[model samples]
Target: MDAEQSIADEPEVTEKRGLFGRNKLATSEPKPAKTLGPLKMIWAELAKYPGKVALAFIALVITAAATLAIPAGFKLIIDNGFAAGGNPDDIGRWFRYLLMIVGVLAVGTALRFYFVSWLGERVVADIRLKVQDNLLRLAPGFYEENSPSEISSRMTADTSLIEQVVGTTVSVALRNILMGIGGTIFLFWLAPGLTVGLVIAIPLIILPIMYFSRRVRNISRSSQDRVADVGSMVSETLGAMKVVQAFNQESREKTRFEGAVEAIFDTAKKRILLRALMTSIIILFIFGSITLIMWRGALGVSTGEISGGTIFAFVVTGGLVAGAFGALTEVYGDLLRGAGAASRLNELLKAKPSIAPPERPQTLPLPPRGSLSFRNVTFRYPTRLETAALKDFNLEVEPGETVAIVGPSGGGKSTIFQLVERFYDPQAGTIRIDGVPLASADPAEIRKRIALVPQDGVLFSSNARDNLRYGNWDASDEDIWEAARAANAESFLRDLPDGLDTYLGESGTRLSGGQQQRIAIARALLRDSPILLLDEATSALDAESEQLVQQALDNLMQNRTTLVIAHRLATVRSADRIVVLEKGQIVEQGTHRELAAANGLYSRLAALQFTSSDAA
Candidate 1:
């Protein structure tokens, strides 16, 4: 089985790595270390959009200033127009003040909405583009260990948290800061004595907000992490619906999913409760301060030290300060939550791909007709420890020479293809092409010279023409048709309603196994690379298709340096040289007739299936 199919055969949690392949996290090791916060890293990322952020911040300040000014207008109308013995013209002045306040608010509100929304959209788009670029740059080995679902969930769900920071929280924070500061100044201006009484309350309120803000941030991050777990579960289950039904495990799988969902709900409920408590505490503090100031203002009015109008103005200004500060506390909680998400996204952004191209590497020549060699090569899989996949293995293939590797399941047959493709570097020796080390060669440049048709012939959900053209993006219509003919797929393709334009529904499920394999071979032929690796290309085909497809493959392999890994004895019967592997060692090497006469592992394997007629 191929790596992806092998993963699909296991339990959903165990199988998650292949379909959405990712590295499994073990509790034995420490959990992923959390980055310290209030993270300045977020500011560093946000700094990339300084122009938009600055404009949004300015708009928020203006809006808050407008909101604070409204209460001042009320104070003026009460003290100057409603006071005993006030001039009748004062009413007209108050009317003009109210209209100016409303106009300022309207403009400020509109500017804040426009700028913040634009910034949010732009930042998220940039982040997604950067993520895709990074994933493209990663080598296959990196993906072999990491689940695709984990990466996808982080990219889609985790980055969404940053939207609030870019579009809403940023502006809200600025507005609240301005409102709090502006309201405090107005309060001092109207009644310095009352401002002194409320001064003590400000610290009491601020201290709790600061403490709870950090707690909320930690909890929100924990909540989002649980959400990612559920996403991983759902992605794995949906991808393996076939197996779930085959085994009649639908009820068991549903119950497992429900458990995951319930865990998420528990975490989310905690987050919601914390947010609610914080908002309520802030509200109570504001109202308590407001009550005390009102009582004091009433006493002053009755003593005749302050007029009823002055008492009214004092109450208006005090209420404004209290309300502004209270709202500031609420908005601050949202900022904390957004900050948590920003931290998660920023972690992914900072992750470096394990494989990277050399800074000053030589470019590979087009149509690389160069010698390939492995000298004492050795490699171990990430998860296994009993033995290496390839140990002290050595081979040399001259340009245009076709060599086939034949072995039992764990005899290191596939490892030869993997190393030749440079998916994993050998631990003990060197791999070179044309005297240039594979390690020093640019990964993209190296891959360009080789084509691999993996055992499963994996297909994408795309039209036949587009899928075939993926082999060579610059290929013409004739080139595609010719390649398809060479793979023995032209006949079936022509019978389809739209031929090359026909959509191959999700992974080519509409086609039979043999047809899909032929399409994959067509893709490889279109690539027209110097080195070709076929891992049992005809293993999944029936006798009829295999015979027809074998003729096409013979033509495709004629001038290329081919490395074939096969279990079927008949496929390798005509190979120029066959290397028989046993426990990562090459036990025998020769032509089919020579090896069979020797009566060794090769003879036994041949006796199993390689009759003269089958070979023909």
Candidate 2:
């Protein structure tokens, strides 16, 4: 196999082996968590706003207390207000007391909703910030094994689930627990015999609901996965719409998306069906028990063992208790879903970059020297451990020198740039910038001294000024124009409607290929780093554009150490030295004419290109 293809075909790491794996978002669902323990992560975030939490809890308690108080208030009204020959003033007083309880319940519920929802929104925002901060710290290899789109889904969908848990589910669960306990006590107070019967029936009400709930929970997870599949499909198809249309595969894409949508519908049906069954069981057991208790209470009332007021209070409070428990069963399932979301987010939060500066890091020397060296380097990508991209490679470039590397595809051309920037650590070798080993120096410091113009000009969705000054954020407008002039970008940039302030479309798509490449060259020029890496920088340009960019590069490289990777042999004829590589080893190194005369790999490659040019 070609070396480059071998490198590209490496298997992604699957150590965690579930949702984090590449393409796993649509293909797999994580195992359902056995408990709600993962929700503690959400609690930790909630704990940051202690005052809000306290207010919410206070409001929740008040609401529950007021809810139970209504029954007591009703008991007074029924027993006294309508008592035979009761005083008119006494009747009005009892009615007013009941109305007051209703008012308190209303106000307390609004407060509870406000505070809990505030906590929920605040926690999710904080978590998103923290997760994003960690994601930026990770190395490129991490992304190779993990799909960014899947990670984004976790950021959005999972966080939304957590928001619901914090804002609604937890609050509901707590309030109901208070009501269930408080209401049950009131029930026993009104009629002990009846409360006993109600209590005994509680397990029967909960058991069947729990059974159906387990089924619902499993299907709920699958339902979420199916929805994620639909989302991924839409994103994938839309992102490659041009390709789909170009190949006339629109129908195939439509069919694929329809399949995903149908899958979601199927999964949702199972979850909803189970939920419906659970709801039915809750009603049957709870109301049926309430009816039986009322029948028994009626007998006591007839015997004068209980007042009509007492029986009314008992039944009302008993209903509240039963309703609370029923709500709890549903709340438990929601909490578990939140726990699953928390677990996934927690993984991202806890992820440590494989490459990080050591404690007591060695600092690169002041007054940057454009010197770089690779010593006995033998390395394979994490995904492709069997094939080495670079093997026993050694080279050194002095300050202010230019070295051109030309080779067959996948001759470790791009791999050299990868290591120089410390994107990956070689399994066996030491790479140094200014004589400081990369592992001992901060990766940021190593990268600060090198500027790269990759095969493609990568730009962000921002204004031209921001894209131009990306490498040097502090660059003045004057400095920017100077760099642009050197990069042959100033002419067209000045012609833009908004000049430097014009918004560049995503990835600079509005710009032509040559224009984007020139912008990239200008960016590197603005960086003014000691060392430069040009990976086929002019390969994408037309003849005129290439000449202009090559001129700009010449000015840019005057005082810098430059490493150029090119397949076009004519471009490197003037380099200080040329190195030829094949099958991950350096086969020859010399001046271009010397290598051309030697009839080695470089000579043959140069012959192929120059001969083709002459024929054309």
Judged by lDDT, which candidate is best? 2
After the best TM-score superposition of candidate 2, give how far the Cα of residue 521 lies from its true spot, in angstroms.
Answer: 1.8
Question: Which portions of model 2 miss their true places by more than 4 Å?
Answer: 1-31, 84-91, 213-283, 542-548, 607-611, 614-616
lDDT scores in order: 0.74, 0.85
Error of 2 at 516 (Å): 2.2
Q: For every model in order, what is the number of clashing pairs?
A: 9, 0
> In TM-score terms, which candidate is top?
2
Q: Per-residue lDDT tens digits of candidate 1, residues 315-340?
A: 66556565566556655545665555
Error of 2 at 309 (Å): 3.2
Q: Give the per-residue Cα lDDT of candidate 2 at 352.
A: 92
State the lDDT of candidate 2 residue by residue for 1-616, as single tens digits: 1212222222222233344564332322233366989889988998899999999999999999999999899889888897746888889999899999999999999999999999999999999999999999999888887877668877887898888899999999999999999998888788888888888898887788667765665666566667767777888889999999999999999888888888888877876677677777777887788788788888998999998889888888887897799788777766886887888889999999988989989999989998999999998988888999999999999999899998999899899998899889999989988898999999998999999998899999999999999989999999999999999899999999999999989999989888898899999999999999999988878888788878878888889999999866555876898888897889999887788778788777876766755312
